[model samples]
Target: MRLSDGPVALRPLRMRDAQPWHDLRRENHTWLKPWEATRPVDETPEMSFANMVRRLRAEARAGRTMPFAITWSGTFIGQLTVSGITWGSLCGGHIGYWIDKGHAGRGVMPTAVALATDHALQTMGLHRVEICIRPENANSRRVVEKLGFREEGLRPAYLHIDGEWRDHLVYVITSEEIPGGLLNRWRATHGPLHA
Candidate 1:
């Protein structure tokens, strides 16, 4: 699947994207390290980029996750995944993303998020979408804030990050919250996000 707004777009991650993806991650290591998820037990070894993408593709095929490679002006710059999806009585998923340090601001992440959230709720028939942000991550929090996601308290010691468990604030939005759709609301508030 692909979603775009001006220069920002999201597409299913592909194996051919390995080089750029690795290059960006290596270059932004310091900028992104603090927010990186780490394995606490080390029971399972870390996966290589190719292995990671293969596993994500398997999950995508199983309908458990939507792993997207974020692009700006058709250039790979980041990633966004709507994971932990559940069906039946509770149809929902949580989103996680990180962008290149150079594109940190300029409405790129917000537009990408809105596009993903809209696709999740509108096209995927999901009931709700959520994002969990580390309380100290003001940048990530700001993205959800700009999109008007409701603050739903905190998840203490939520997920392991930067080598330790971290507290995260839950932000959520349901289909009912944006009957007219999220991208429309984003455009209404922020205008076009070209360039």
Candidate 2:
């Protein structure tokens, strides 16, 4: 399911993506480390490509989770994942994503998110989606805000990262609020968002 706005496409994550994923992550380690889960030195060895492939494939085989590698033309740029999916009365999940430092501000995550959210709602019949971002991560908060997810409130000690508990701002969106969906709302409103 590629969502195109020119030439870029947000597609599914592939097993072979391990190499590019590793390369990009390693290159952005300094930029990504603060917000990402801190791993043991051994856990983040520069040569754990096999582990990435195996884990990603196994996770994809399970029905409740979906992850994608953001791409442009033919380059793997980053990752986006929607996990903890629930059914029945609560069709919801949590979203986590990161953009390659080179791709951070070029609409990659936003488009990836729009396409992924469509899958959550239309394909999986989900009702809502949530994202909790560190209070200091203004850029991440902007991404959720651009998608129109309301601020749900503060969650003190919400995420475990950098080997410590941290606070986060909860943001959420429901199917009904999207007006058929994000692309539709954008088409109706004309252009993307800011702030």
Candidate 3:
């Protein structure tokens, strides 16, 4: 399923996107490296893009994840994933995303995130959605805060980032908190989503 708000859109990631994705990563290497996840020394080397896509696709098929390619004005700019989905007693999932540095501060990322969160909570019938951000990542933190996600707490050594374990501040929003929808709430304050 595709999710969108004006020019910002999230669609299923595909192998056909490898070239542009790699090019964007290469271009934004310096800008994104510090916030990007890295494998520990004990683990195997990073998987190839093809292999990574294959694995993510498998997870999507199993209903464990929704890996999406973020687009702005129909051009691929980044990625967003609704992962770690849980059902039954706990119907929830967390979101992770990144955007091309050129697209930063333009409201694209927030719109993409809101779209994904709405899809997870409204379309998929999930109860809650969370976004974990490095404490130092002011931009990322602002995205959720602007969307009205409450700051839950800090997670010590949450996930491996930039070759080291980094502390992340957890932000969460439950379906009951926004009966009118998060996107509507965000739009109410931010005006139009597109630049």
Candidate 4:
């Protein structure tokens, strides 16, 4: 499935995206390093792009994840994924994303995130969606703030980022809170974008 509004779009990540994805990661190494998750030192080696795509696809098929490639003006720019979906009573998922440094502050990330969150709530039948942002990640925090997600609390050493565990500010929004939908709320609050 694909989700989009204005110039920002999110679609399933493809194997063909490997080269651009790798290049973007390389270019944004310094920009993204601090927020990127790191595996345990003793874990198995990192998987290749193809393997990663296969794994994500399998997860998507299992209804456990939604792996999407973020694009702006028809150009690939980043990635956003709604992962760790739980259905029993929780019926929620967590969102994680990264964008090229050049695309920051232009509303691209927020728009992409809003689209994904709305999809999770509406199409995926999820009740809640969570976004965990490192306390120091002002840009990411802004995305949630812009969407009016309530700050639940702080998670100490929540996830291993860069090289060590980091504290994250937990933000959450339930479907009932966004009855009009996240994209609609964003557009109403921020006005329509030219891009």
- Return the lDDT, model 3, position 120: 88
| TM-score quality measure for candidate 3 | 0.96
- Candidate 3: residue pairs that collide: none
- Per-residue lDDT of model 2, residues 1-195, tens digit only: 555544355667766787788789889998888898653443645436566556655776776677677777668888788888888799898889888887787666776677788778877789999988999988888787777789999999877777678888989888888758875554355464332
lDDT value, candidate 4, whole model: 0.92
1-195: candidate 1 lDDT, tens digit per residue: 789999999998989999999999999999999999999998987788899999999999999999999999999999999999999989999999999999998999999999999999999999999999999999999999999999999999999999999999999999999999999998999999878
Specify the poorest-scoring 10-residue window by lDDT in model 4. 38-47
Q: Quick one: ranking by lDDT, best first?
A: 1, 4, 3, 2
In order, candidate lDDTs are 0.95, 0.76, 0.91, 0.92
- C-alpha TM-scores of all predictions: 0.98, 0.85, 0.96, 0.97
Identify the leading candidate in terms of lDDT: 1
Better of 1 and 4 by lDDT: 1
Point out where model 3 deviates above 4 Å: none
**What TM-score quantifies how close candidate 1 is to the native fold?**
0.98
Per-residue C-alpha lDDT of model 3 across residues 1-195, encoded as one tens digit per residue: 787888988998888899999999999999999999987775787688899899999999898999999998889999999999999999999999999999999888888888888888988999989999999999899899888899999999999999899999999999999888888887889977653
lDDT comparison, 1 vs 2, better candidate: 1
Candidate 4 C-alpha lDDT tens digits along 20-70 = 999999999999998989985847888899999999999999999999999
Worst 10 residues of 3 by lDDT: 39-48
